[model samples]
Target: MLPDGMTRRDLGWAITGILGVFFAAMISMNVVVTALPVIVSELHGTQIQYSWVVTATLLANASSTPVWGKLADMMSKKTLFQVANVIFFLSSLTAGFAPNMETLIGARFVQGIGLGGLTALAMAILASIVSPRERGRYAGYFGACLATATALGPLVGGITVDTLGWRWCFFVGVPLSLMALVLVGFTLRVPVLEVRGRIDYLGALVLVLTSGALLIWLSFAGTPEFFDWISWESAVLLALAMVLLVFFVMIERRVSNPIIQLRMLVSRTTLLAALSSASIAVCLFGMPAFLGQYFQIGRGLSPTESGMMILPLVLGNLIGTMTTGRLITRYGRWKPYIVVGSLILTCGMFGLATVDSGTPFWFVLTVLVVVGLGFGAQMQNLMLAVQNTVQVTRVGQASALIAFFRVFGGASGTAILGSVMAMQVVGVSVAEVNGTAPSATYADASGTMFLVAACLTLPAVVLNLLIKEVPLRTTI
Candidate 1:
């Protein structure tokens, strides 16, 4: 037996359990992405509603992530992880049975809460046992699971929709999550911190309110064809969002255990890490949500064909993550990977910005590879940077903070970019009604959408360059 009476065989089981939890959470997300167009059309939802169905989960994930992260410190990580799975399965069941756009969106919000628990607690639970340096060694397995989910989710969703129905995309995730719940209960055993502090309900409330309001306002702004951006509706929401944010900061400063410890933000490294994480979030989660539209609507590909096209991106992500994780673990250094990843992000997205309907399949695949490479190199390493700077017990808070920002970035980028995309598409759709070709219109607008994301990558490059490379801890 090892020092804690845990054997090597036990580590293998624990990792399996964690991986299952991740796959259940992540795959359920991507599965719905490609199927969304069909769902919206079937439900007679608008462009804005379509974006909400996806981003609503993300917003809820962002809001509840810290709450779950904090819970890890006060309870059994294993129990919380299993509880999250139950919540996820139930939410998926609710979503699968949703008869309208409103019900589906509501179901997704609940699912996001469950996803927050899985995503945040999984990382925290692993950190509770594994050191940051060694995380790289095992991170490849994590990356592969993530990449596989990303790569296959759309493919499965497309096939399911074509053969069975769109509801199956939501339905299938339930069994997988239930399986993960059972597996984690049987396999995962870890010590909990059991920190003595009251939960920060006010800070949590304001954090969610501010974040939800901001994204909600952006969602409104995205569909300006329905309403003006300068209208009272947008102005009033934006005003409340700002006011809530100010109050959030104040509440955080006074709270015994803030959802996010305000003191952590003072670190230059943490700030850089936050910015870098935000940028990578745009690249990883925000950018990919639109490919189905481009392939099916813009280029007239079949669902299965569009699913096939997603493989290159998934493979690209897998290769990047595997390469970066091994190197970081070996060298115990992460700066070069971050720099290279940022550069790849800028290059890949900028290249994709010029794409049109007739853009070569090979060229698009190549650019997606670069994006995957960049995403792989940056995403996990940024988390490592943040965790290294904090006390071990407080790693949950740090991980949640970085994760919270990623949720913020992913939701905000999708909202803003989705708006830009919808406005342009609707403009051209109106023109199409007046004789413009739908394919040509969508292709041109898609290029502009990518260009906006590409331009956003530049700031991240600057932030990554500025991150102070503090020495990583060699032990937990």
Candidate 2:
């Protein structure tokens, strides 16, 4: 930790450097969403291929998180930050120059590896330096940066695709990442924990394979035309994933220093925090992906217009997160926010389920703002709750575990919702052409998707109610 009574500038530089890397990585991931349709159409890739473009990154991210977190615990955070930034920069360049959809997708996978390191390591480092009470203020700032980046990604991506090309969206992240690298090199300093231990190569491999297989299964589950539940290929892949996952658990149990500590997961706080993180991920990531599509396909809006319409959600998120941060610092309790946020989220989602092709744009915007507020209030609070509960030594692992589940949930949620939307559209089209009475040009699938999302969050609300609030730590 920095010397006691460090100047505000010292704090400013550290926070800025960490948040810069986070903003760059998050913006790069989100920018592609609005540009996806244009990118796929230009490259002649199918919708399934388009979905994989996002899923591939998420898969790499989820698999690599524990590895990065372990490395952060064992090595210099400065070294890891530099390495992650360099990898991110190179991958961004490669993606910008990718000649085909396949190459772009491959570049995104590499980018995700770099991003996983930066995000998990950055958070771990911050938590190490700050008291839990003060950490929320900084976490709030980080949340604001994330909200801003997410909000701007689609708008900037739309403009780039319209004027220059979709490739520039990838290029845009390079300078930001470079800036982060420079900031870390100049301003950030943390002692490396030197340790001699064998890396868990087998555990890592099994975990990656298991996660990749599950993601592939989800991606192609309903779209592959052979949704045959009893297919030999499906059974084989499913069995392989389950067996590998079980082996990974066994390996973690035996390792001297596991990549992820399975013991922490048994704690009620950790388990509930992970579940809450996953539920929020499903709500946060699933909505934006489909909202862009809804605007373009269902309502015939341009990419730029669709992005502009979603700005209110971002604004609400910024306000809610910052406010919650101050409130948590003042009250020194977190459970209330979780319960209240989930209930608000449920209400917003229920409202969203009634949206249709003829629904007013204002109504849709209002509901999204409500959803964003709920997210801002709950997302970081859950992580903080988990971080406060764990001892300092295991903080990195605990934090990474929470983030890992959140990303995994997001990836699975997007694939699941996309599949639902695809089936709904197909069913509507088939029925319409078969002489079924049709009053509308096309059925809106967004409402149905929101209903399913609401159902998923209902359980999360119950889980939140059970979370007991522990007092904020006063010292490290």
Candidate 3:
């Protein structure tokens, strides 16, 4: 049986609120991209710190996703969703007034907490209302929302930064967040899975510690001066993280109401979907960090121009996501779209690897569109796969797990790729490039990063192949 009053429903205005929640979160993330370099320069933040601005938010998002999902399972999804939005709303306002890198990063961390809830709860609600077979069409709308937000984010950031300075980018999303809250607050209705037990506080502690330690390592490893990958600091942190992970596992095994269910995790469908998400994440997170820099620095474009230049990526993403989502729903199969997405992603990455500052703008745009297309197609399916494999009661945690892996992978990719860019920039400075060395350095670095990123997709494809497609359930 389903929760009372929320069964056999098709999306209505509630879809507006759901998409609004996602759009608000995406706007906040995207709006900051073009403003990042300016924010760093204005704040006198180090390159490491500049990279941390994005990575910090992602880490926080990853860490909090499961907690938020678990809370939705134990409590009211609608209330939890609103709470997350309020956190984002307040934090965005605070972020606009931030005087330094520390304050901005802190605000982003809080914003990420809200974003995590939106991400997890949005999917849970989708799964709760829409059947797996019909979910793809609706999921396509979700993907379109993401693509639209991403497409417009750079434009919004650029226009705001150019007109009102960088701070307004942070502030602009506030009204949208408020709108989402009001819409969802009044319209959203869903049944909560009633479970009796205390929240696994100890599991949360160990999980955070474990995730924190690993993220710290990812944030700093192999960068210019932070910590060497083979250094004692690395060893100590990794060791501690591993031990805590072990402890977290043990704690979950014994907990009466575990936040994460190991049995659910071990299932082939869920496991493979998670693995696929990690690679897709590398693409998703790596793009904003690298391509954002490329347009601004490498291509010698203004923020507005860069934003416009990146629109094709969003277009590609929209096509891929919506096309796959629609096709999957209509045909009642998912594997074909996923495989095609993987191929397209790898092809795009390889094409991007060949690009330099002098490469034709059209070529670059086409390649990015390819990447976006692949990501659009692959991303939601990963979540759908997990949702399909689990029961309704498992929806919240299962959805959270998929999001957690994607964000965690994104955090790792962003940090690692950011470090690579910084290291190459340092290398360029040491060798003395002739003209506009910083931009040249960024160009040289990004080409290689794209090639490396292509390698990341192969494993995800392998995992996707292992995902056995169970027939999608027709009812919620």
Candidate 4:
């Protein structure tokens, strides 16, 4: 039932407002993908900085996600959402005018903090107002918006970079965010209840430290100037990360309101879905980060052309998610879709693993379609399954925990895969110098990156297989 005094029209407007925020956030997250090459070159950045530019944002988003989720369970969701939007707007504007790569990255990190809140809170608010059974259709709408923003990101970013310059890529989201903020202020209405729960400040700190240490280790592991994978630096960093993780676990167990609720993992479904979400993210986030380099640098395509080439993936994502979402709601069957999606995703990753600069455009487009379809079908539905297991009161925590895993995995995987590609490029360069290879290109290294992604994704298929399908709950 609708809350007292709430009408369906109110709900529709609220959803529109929510989607606007989501659309703007997604655009900010993805607009840099195609433009990173130009951005790095103009700022005189190295390969490591190229990856960190993306990694920094993912790390910030992942680290802050649980806290945002926890807060939604305690505070006014509407107020928190606006606060996040404002943060995103201000940070995006700062990033647009940044004169150096370091400043851009710092701004991106702050931007990520806002993205984290918007991401976790959107689902929490939806759960507060809609039942899981009905949520599937709305989730489909969310997925469509996501696919659209994701689709437009590369194209718009390419055009912006090609014509107006790279700075405009960041500026484009400012107005969109402002529009969302205004719409949400006028339309979004949820009861502010008198909930009492302490924020887990200590746990949040330990979690950030742990994730930061691990990412640092991954990003610089084999870079000769920094340290080797097996050197003393790696050992110290890894040990520190592990110790912090242990502390984080201990803190969570004792805290009144832990950032991540350990109790949720005890559920078999939640555990598997979390694992699968993390695994799937390695490909979902990693592919776009590298594909621009593959098309532009390796294959000698312009940013505009690369953006046009990526259309198949986004189109497939739109088709897959929209189709499966409605099907799940209609037939009340979700597990089969997830399992099948996992298989398709795995196959696509393996197929991409074989691609090189010389690969035919048609073959690349076909594989991208498969990959997009797999991701679209799997991403939101996993959250839907987890949200089904929790009551409305705890939905924020449950939903955010799953999002944490997804972003965490994406950050880690991006760091590792980016390092792998960087190292591969170095090796190929050396081989070219010694006359052992004819060329050194990101196209060659990209195959190795996708191979690693495929290996990581292999586990998700098994994890999803073990998830027990539960009937969708009918009431809030």
Candidate 1 structure quality by residue, lDDT tens digits, 222-261: 4756556888888889999989999999988887777887
Q: TM-score of predicted model 1?
A: 0.95
TM-score of each prediction = 0.95, 0.94, 0.95, 0.96
For model 2, the stretches where C-alpha displacement exceeds 4 angstroms are 1-7, 224-226, 427-443
lDDT of 3 by residue, 1-476 (tens): 33355433424767788798789888888878877767776787766787788887888888889888788788878888889888988988999999988999998888888888888999988787778898889899999999999988888888888889999988877887888888777666777677778999889877777877887887678887787889999999999999999999999999888878888877988888887898879877667756777877776777787788889989999999988888888888998788778878888888988877778899999888888988888999889878888888879999999999999888888877777776767644321221233466677677887777778777876787777887778887
lDDT of the candidates, in the order given: 0.81, 0.78, 0.82, 0.86
Error of 3 at 124 (Å): 0.6
> What TM-score quantifies how close candidate 4 is to the native fold?
0.96
Q: Which candidate, 1 or 4, has the higher TM-score? A: 4
Encode model 2's per-residue lDDT on 1-476: one tens digit a residue. Answer: 45344456766887787788789898898788677767777776666666667877887888888888777777776787789888888999998888988998999999989888887888888777788988888889878887898799878887888788889989888878888877777776665565578778778888889899888777666654536335776788789889989999999989877888888888898898888788878766667766766665567666687677778778778887898988888888788888998888888889988877898999989988998898888888888999998866667777788888888887777777766665566533322221233223333677887788887677679888888788999765
Which has the better lDDT: candidate 2, or candidate 4?
Answer: 4
Task: Kindly give the stretch of ten consecutive residues in candidate 3 with the minimal lDDT sum.
Answer: 428-437
How large an RMSD does model 2 have?
3.5
Model 4 lDDT at residue 309: 80
